[model samples]
Target: MSGERSGDRTERASDLMQLNAMALEETELSLHEDADGRGDPAAAERLHRLADSMTDTARDIADRARNLADPVPERERR
Candidate 1:
């Protein structure tokens, strides 16, 4: 990763984030502790929060990658 290009790094990070999100969604943590075999609401909520944060960070990284690829002129940048 030390020598990785910006686009490659961005794609890798995005893919990893997606993989983790899928893993979290498939995890047994959401299974209920009772004999009913129902879903656990707290676990589901925590999963969603984690997934959302990962997604948001991936988006931010992508935005940074895009900016690095085609940066605004010094005078034009906000």
Candidate 2:
């Protein structure tokens, strides 16, 4: 049986990706502040790493949603 309705699934996935992207942006700003103004190199480095990981995860989530939303080709119809 199908689990989530397609529209709901797509909306939820998009929301999650957007949230992650926002988090990444916030982390980047924090990283810049910590490095350039706060004199906390260690914190900046950690935040930088977190931002990078978040970016990768967000892209993966978007890719997954895109793959799910793609229609099956007529030649491949069951």
- TM-score for all models, in order of appearance: 0.50, 0.53
Tens digit per residue, CA lDDT, model 1, 1-78 = 899988787666666656555554444333222313427767666656665665566566556555655657889976
Largest TM-score belongs to which candidate? 2
Write down the lDDT of every candidate, Cα atoms only.
Answer: 0.57, 0.67
Q: Which sections of candidate 2 miss by over 4 Å?
A: 1-36, 72-78
Query: Where does candidate 1 have its weakest 10-residue lDDT segment?
Result: 29-38
Q: Could you tell me the lDDT of residue 21 within candidate 1?
A: 51
Residue 44, candidate 2: Cα error in Å is 0.6
Model 2: per-residue lDDT, tens digit, 8-63? Answer: 87777767766766676676566656556545778767766775776677667666
Error of 1 at 76 (Å): 1.3
